[model samples]
Target: IANDNPYKYQRRLASITSATVAELDVAIPDPGLTTAVAVTVSDPIDVENGAMFSVFQAACDHEFAKLIRHKDLRRYHSWYQMKLREALMADQRDETIQNGYMQDSDEWGLPLGEVEY
Candidate 1:
């Protein structure tokens, strides 16, 4: 799931992700512990432990580079664009005092949305 290639509507996350916080103990791979162990995407939790975030980061970095090099968004798959969008929105919303939106006009982004691309 961290690769941004979660596959077919995010189903790959089922083994590791959950809606309830109570189950997070085992469902979520602890970044510190899992980073050192030999892990795989097939692991019951986390593809790289916390290091998988780097995988996702690498994917994003690739898209960014592609955009810079070609001035286009057509090369990457829709899933890549969708995840990037979500990540951007989350980052925008995470700012404590200034999140790049004006209360008077700019609308705060939702955490999730229908893929529009």
Candidate 2:
């Protein structure tokens, strides 16, 4: 059920991801851990939240870089252009913050995907 709470989305998304990741066996070339060991060390790097958030950050970084390099909207002088610039800046800030969150979570042994490409 879709809860009307804004926070529910984040939590629901995490739960879905955990379910999916839980189903996937460790992607190791060889199996070594027994069920007990797996339960203790299993991580979510290959899961939904980590991968999803990583992708978001990567895309944001790419777009921000492109904007800074190209300055494609430089020629414009309109309300729309102003809004675009503001939105892009905000997105960059958000991406940075998300990155920090992911890093901290990963440090705590929550699998946040590899450093985004």
Candidate lDDT values, in order = 0.42, 0.37
In model 1, the worst 10-residue window by lDDT is 19-28
Cα TM-score per model: 0.21, 0.20
Q: Cα deviation of 44 in candidate 2 (Å)?
A: 23
Model 1 lDDT tens row, 13-73: 3333443311223333445543233333454434433334544865676578566875444
Give the number of the best model, judged by lDDT. Answer: 1
- Per-residue lDDT over 3-72 for candidate 2, one digit per residue giving the tens place of the 0 to 100 score: 3333211111123345435333334333553233323222435524443444444555546655677453
Please list all clashing residue pairs in model 2, or write none if there are none.
none
